[model samples]
Structure formats: C-alpha cells, structure tokens
Target: MNRIEKRMQELQQRGEKALITYITAGLPDMEGTKKLIRAQEEAGVDVVELGIPFSDPVADGPVIQDASYRSILKGTTLRKVLAMVKELRAEGCEQPLIFMMYYNTVMSYGVQNFADACVEIGIDGLIIPDLPMEEQGELKEALAGREETVIIPLVSPVSGDRIPKLVGDAKGFVYCVSSMGVTGNGGQFHAHVAEYLKQVKAVSPIPVMMGFGIRTAADVLPVKDVIDGAIVGSHFIQLMEESGYDTEKAKEYIRTFKTELNA
Candidate 1:
C-alpha cells in the first residue's frame, strides 16, 4: 500500500482522525515549499496535498487563485514540483505526498507520462479537481501497473446519486467537499453538512475526508464522528501568507490546531 492508504489504516487502528494538509507546490518560492511540507509533517499532518500551480485554477477561490498565480509568475512548472518531491524523498521524507492539479495541466504534460513520473517519484495519489468521474478511464489505464499511485476521486455536497459511484472506486480517503463552492476559508457551512457527510460516509467503505471551508479545528469537531478526517487547504495557505511564509510558525500553529481538534 502507498503511504496514503497505510496512514489512513494506521489512523483507523488508533481510533484517531487523520490530518491532511494542502499547499501550492511553488508558493512563497520553490525551496520554501519543501520546508513547508516538512514542517506540516512534523506538526502532525498525516498527508500532504502538493498543489501543482496552474494558469487557470477554476475550482480555486480568490486566495488559492492568488497563490497559484504567484507561483506561476515564479515559473513553477509541473516538472519542478515533481523534482521537489524527488528531493524530499532523497532526504528521507516519507510523508504521503499527493498531487492536486487541474486536468488541463495533466493533458499538456501527457497523462501517462505524468502518472509514470508520480510512480517513479513515490507520489501516493493524484487529485485532479476538474477531472470528471466519466473521464477517469484513460487516467486509470495510465495508472494500471502502479497500484501505489492512485487517482483519488472527489465527492461534492451536491453529488446526488453520483456519490456512491465516486466513492466505490475511490483510492485514498474520499475528499468530500463540505460546501458547494470553490476552495476558500471561512465560508459558511450549512446545517445539512453533517447530513451530507453522513450520506458520503454511508457509501464510502474507505475513510471520508471533508474539505473546503474547513479552517479551524472547531470546524471539524462537529463532524469528527461522522467522517474519518478533515482536509485543510486555503486556510493553511492564508496562515502561511500571514506568517510571511515562515514555515516554522505555520507548524506551531498546526500543532495548536491539532490540540484543539483533539480536545
């Protein structure tokens, strides 16, 4: 099993929730991204979603969009981000690292080639937010031999009848979008979020991780029992921004957040 599955299984055995974090690969500069990933792991983040910067991140909110744009301006390409992963692995960082990219980038990079590169570099999974369930066939074929490299599917609150199908073939813990919007922090979560998550958990045999608008630890407490874990993204980017890209400070903040979540 890849680290993603292994970590989830380990968390399940311990009766503890997983803490998955996200950051743009080239944000605050390239080298800073590497340090940020390591900081997160040290601070109790279970998995790291390394977001590949894209020219047009349709699913991203303003904050993530700004970060992506900055990374792009710094000339952060997919190739560079993968190189960073290789460097981290060489340095003995075994944190489960997954790529979160848009489909257009994958298309330009050649899907099979991208999948093979992920396998070669020890990447656990790929989360293409814009990749539709119906279009997963080619990517699945590309990832055929590499069971360790998975294509993680997403479930939205408005997924309706599609939730079962998405989670049925889900690889890592299913990422269920907590609200019906692009990725951003401090967005309003509705009362039915718990009910929506309950439905997702009912269908998903694997762990269900709720993302989108989950900023604080308290935000996760209510649905902690209803899901396996919570995915924090834009809020983390915001935190890093506030810290002026000081990863050490970010890690300390995350440690505090974990305490609050557990309490």
Candidate 2:
C-alpha cells in the first residue's frame, strides 16, 4: 500500500480522525511552503494537501484564490511544485503529500506527463477538483502505471445519484466536500454533511475525508465518527498569512490545532 492508504488504515485502526492540512505551494514563497509542510508533519498531521496554483481556481474561495494568484505571480508552476516535493523528500520529510489542483493545469502539462512527474517526485496522491468522474478515464489510465500516485475523487452533497459511481472509482480516499458551495464560505457543518458522509462511507470502500469550512476542532468534533479525516485549509492559510510566514508561529498554530482535535 502507498503512504496514503497506510495512513488511512492506521487512523482507522486507532479510531481517530486524521488531520489533513492544505497550503498553496510557493505561497509566501517556496521556502515557506516547505516549512509549512514540515511543520504540519511535526504537528501530527496525517496528510498534507499542496495546492498547485492555477490562473482560475473555480471551486476555491477568496482566501485560496488570492493565495493561488500570489503563488503564480511568484513563479510557482507545476514543475516547480513537483521539484519542491523532490527536495522535501531529500530532506527526509515522509508525510504523505497530495497535490490539489484544477484540470486545466494538469491538461496543460498533459495527464500522463503530470502523473509521471508526480510519481518520480514521490507524491502520494492527486486531488483534481475540477476533473469530473466521467472525464477521468485518461488520467486514471495514466496514473495506473505509477505505483506512488493515487487519484482521489471529490464528492459533494449535490452529487446525488452519481455518488456511488464516483466512490467506486476513487482510490486513495473520497474527499467529501462539506458543502455544496465554494471552500471557506460554509460557516458550519450542515446536517446534510453528516448524512452525506454516512452515505458515502457506506458505499465507499476506501476512507472518506471531509474538507471546506472545517476550521476548528469544535467544527470537526461533532462529525468525527462519521468520516476518516478532516481537512482545514482557509483557517491554516489565514494563520500562515497572519504569522507573516513565521515558521515557528506556523508550527505552533498547527500544534495547537492538532492538540485541540485530539483533546
């Protein structure tokens, strides 16, 4: 099993909710992004979702959108992000690294090429938010050739009858979008989120992880038993920005977040 699969299995065995942290690559700068990833792992984050900034990130909220824009301006391309992952591996950071990106960016680089690149760099998985289930065949075929790269699919509350079909094809895990709207805007977990997670978990053979609007341990605690993991993005980005990329403060914030979740 890959690192992602192993981590999910371990979390499930322990009966604990895994903490997944998201950050835009090359945001603030490459060095800062590396620091954030290391700090998250040190803080007990089970997975790290690295955002590959694109020109138009439709599913993202203002905070992530702005971070993507800044990252792009700072010369954060797909190649650079993969190279950063390679560097991190060289530095001995073993946390599972999953890249969150749009379809356009991957298409621009070509699916096979992107998958090959990720595999070479030791990336554990890919989360293409814009890739619909119906259109994932080509990328899925390409990823099948790589041992290290697993493709994760996102399921939203509005996915309706397609949920089972999507979950069946999903590898690594099913990323359950906590709401129907964009990220960061959903203030609290809806009743639908819990119900949806239950349904997804029932059908999904792999682990189910929820993201978007999961800002605090309090926000995640109520539904902890239903899902395998909780991912916090906007909250962590806000903390990183507020800290002015101070690595120590970023680490401290992640430590606090982890402590609260495990408390």
Candidate 3:
C-alpha cells in the first residue's frame, strides 16, 4: 500500500477520523510552502493534498482561486511542485502527499509521464477534479502499472447511479464533494450530506472522505460517524493568507481542527 492507503488504514484501525489539509504549492513561495507542509504534519494532519495551481480551477472558490492566481503569477508549475515534493522527501517527511490539480494541467504534462514522475517522487495519490470518471482509463492503467499511487475520484450528491461504478474502480479513498459548487467554507452543509455519505459508503469498498464545504471542526464533528475524514481547503488557505504565511499559526489552526474532530 502507498502512504495514502496506509494512513487511511491506520486511521480506521485506531477509530479516528482523518484530518486532510490542502494548500496551494508555491502560494507565497516555495520556502513557505515547505514550511506549511511540515507544520501540517506536525499539527496532526493525516494526509496533505498539495494543490497544483491551474489557470482554470473551476472546482475552487474565491480563496483557492486567488491562491492559484497568486501561485501562477509567482511562476509555479507542475515541475516546480514535483520538485518541492522531492525536497520534502529528501528532508524525510513521509506523511502522505497527494497532488490535487485540474485535468488540463496533467494533459499538458502528458499523463503517463506525469504518473511516472509522481511515482518516482513518492507522491501518494492524484486528485484531478475536472476529469470525468469515464475518461480515466489510460491514466489508471499507467499509474497502476507504475506504483500504488491512488487515483482518487470525486462524487457529488448529484452523481446518482454512477456512484457505484465510480467507487468500484477507485483506489485509495473516494473524495465526496459536500456541496454542489466550488471549494469554500461559506456554504452551509446540506441536510443531504449525511445521506450522501451513506449512499457513497454503501457502494465504496474503500474509505470515503468529504471535502468542498468543510471548513471548521463543528462542520465536521456531526458527520464523523458516517465518513472517514473531512478535507478543509479554503478556510485553511484563508487563514494562511491572513497570517502572512506564519507557519506556527497555520499549525495551530490545524491542531484546533484536529481537536474539534476528535472531540
């Protein structure tokens, strides 16, 4: 098993929910991004999803959209993000690292080469938001043949009968988008979230993790019993921006979220 699968399994065995944190690579700078990753691990985050900034990030909200714009303006590219991951590995930080990007970026990099590069750098998984479930055949074959790097698929509340097939072929964990729109914290968690979790869990052979609207511990606490974990992105990114990239404050936010989940 890769780091993601192992981490999820460990969380399951311990009866604890996973705290997955997402951050844009080279947001403020590469140095700050590295510090943020280390701080996240120190703050008890079970898995870290490194966001690779793309020009058209439809799944992201204003916070993440702004971050992606900043990252791109700073000249962040897929190569730079992968290099940063290599640097982290060289420093011996082995916490599960998953790269989250849009399909166009991967296409620009060549799917097979991208998968091979991730496997080479010890990346645990890939979360491509815009890639449809029907178009994953080539990427899946390439990544599976290379290593156990999980290709995580996202399912929203509207992905009805298709959920079964999506979960059946999915490895690592299934990312459930908690709401209909982009990634943000302002939106209220829908009443259908619990039911959606149950529906996905019923079909998912692997663990199911929810994201999008998840921003606070209170946002996650009530649903911990139904899902494996909650992924918080926009809220954390907002905090990071507000702190001026203060690593300590970021760690404190992560710790507070973890404490709330565990409580």
Candidate 4:
C-alpha cells in the first residue's frame, strides 16, 4: 500500500477519521506553499490536496478561483508545482500528496510524462474532477504498470446510479461532492446527503471522503459516520488569505481546525 492507503488504514485502526485539506500551489509563492504543506503535516492533516492553478476551474468556487488566479499571476505552472513536490520529498515531507487539477493540465503535460513525473516525485494520487469515468482509460493506461499513484474518482449527489461504477475501481479514496454545486459551502447539501453517502460507502471498497461545502466540523457531523474523512478547500484558502498568506498563521488555524475535527 502507498502512503494514502496505509495512512487511511492506520487511521481506521486508531478509530479516527481522515482530515484532508487543500491549498493552491504557489498561492503566495513556491516557498510559502512548501512551508504551508510542511505546516499541514506538522498540524496532523492526513492528506494534502495540492491544487494546480488553472484558468478555468469549473469545480472551484470564488475563494479557490481567486487563489488560483493569484498563483497564476505569480507565474506558477504545472512544471513548477511538480518541481516543488520533488523538493518537498527531498526535504523528507511524508504527507500523502494528491494533485487536484483539471484534465487540460494533464493533457498539456502529456499523460505518460505526467504519470511518470508523479511516481518519480512520490505523489500518491490524482484527483481530476473534470475527467469522466468513461474517458479515464488513457491516463489509466499511462499509469498502467505504476500502481503507486492511483486516480481518485469524484461522485456527486446527483450521480445517483453512477456512484458504484464511479468508485468501483477507485484507489486511495472516493471523493463524494457533498452538494450539487461547486467547491464552497454557500449552499445546503442535497436533501438526502446522508443517504447518498451511505450508498457510496456501501459500494466503495476504499475510504469515502466528502468534499465541497465541508468547511468545518459541524458541516461534517451529519454524515461523519458514513465517511472516512472530509476535505476542506475554500475554508483553508480563506484562512491563509485572512492571515495574509502567512504560513505560520495558517498552520495555527489548521491545528485548531483539526482539534475540533478529532474531538
């Protein structure tokens, strides 16, 4: 098992759910992003979803959209992000890092080349929100012999009958989008979120994590029992922005947030 699978299994053994967090790479700059990730690992975040900034992020909300834009303005590219990951690994950061980006990023980087780069840099997984299940074959093929880095699938409440098929061969974990819309908590969950998660958990062999609108512990409470973890993106970005993108301050916020999550 890779770091993700082992980490999830370790959490299960300890009877604790995962607490995943997201941050746009090069938000304040590469060094700051590196510091933030190290801080997250120090603060006990189970997985860190390093978002690759893209011009068109359909799955993200205003907070993330702005962050991505800022990162892009700073000249952050897919190559820089991968290089940073390599540096992080060299620095002994063991946190399971997952790249959450649009399909265009991968295609631009070349499928096989991207897959090889991920394995070489010790990246544990990929979360391509726009890549549909049916069209995943090419990347899957590129990653053929490489099982270390698995493609994570996303399922929404409206997915209905597609949930099982989406997550059937999923590795690491299945990301369950808590609501119908994008990455923020401005709206309420689909009426039957609890039931929807139950359905995902029933069919998924790996851990089930709910993202989108999962900003705090209370947001996760309702479906906490049905999921193995929660992914907080916009709220984290807000925290960093509120701290003026100060790595130390963001780390403090994450520590406190994790305390509540585990309580």
Better of 2 and 3 by TM-score: 3
Residue 99 of model 1, lDDT score: 91
The lDDT per prediction is 0.87, 0.85, 0.87, 0.89
Residue 182, model 4: Cα distance from true site in angstroms = 0.9
- Which residue ranges in model 1 land beyond 4 Å of their true spot? none
List model 1 lDDT by residue over 1-263, tens digit each.
88999999998898888778889989888888988888888888889999998988988899889999999999999999989899999999999999999988888889889888899999998999888999989989998967889988888778989889998977888988888778884747755899999998988989988889888788888888898887888998888999898978888878877677666
Each prediction's total of clashing residue pairs, residues at least 3 apart in sequence or on different chains, is 0, 0, 0, 0
lDDT of 4 by residue, 132-233 (tens): 999999999988877789999899988988887998878999999888878886437888999999999999999999888776777888777899888889
lDDT by residue for model 3 over 1-263, one digit each (tens)? 88888888888998888889899999789988998898888878999899999888998889899999999999999999889889899999988999999988888899899988899889988898888988988888787655558888889989989999999967889999988888894647666888989999998999999898777878866678899888989888888888898989988888888777877
How far out, in Å, is residue 166 in model 1? Answer: 0.6
Off by over 4 Å in 4: none
Native-vs-model 3 lDDT? 0.87
Q: Which residue pairs overlap in candidate 3's backbone?
A: none
Quick one: how many clashes does candidate 1 have? 0
- Provide TM-scores for the models: 0.97, 0.95, 0.96, 0.97
Error of 3 at 236 (Å): 0.2
**lDDT accuracy of residue 136 in candidate 4:** 92
Worst 10 residues of 1 by lDDT: 182-191
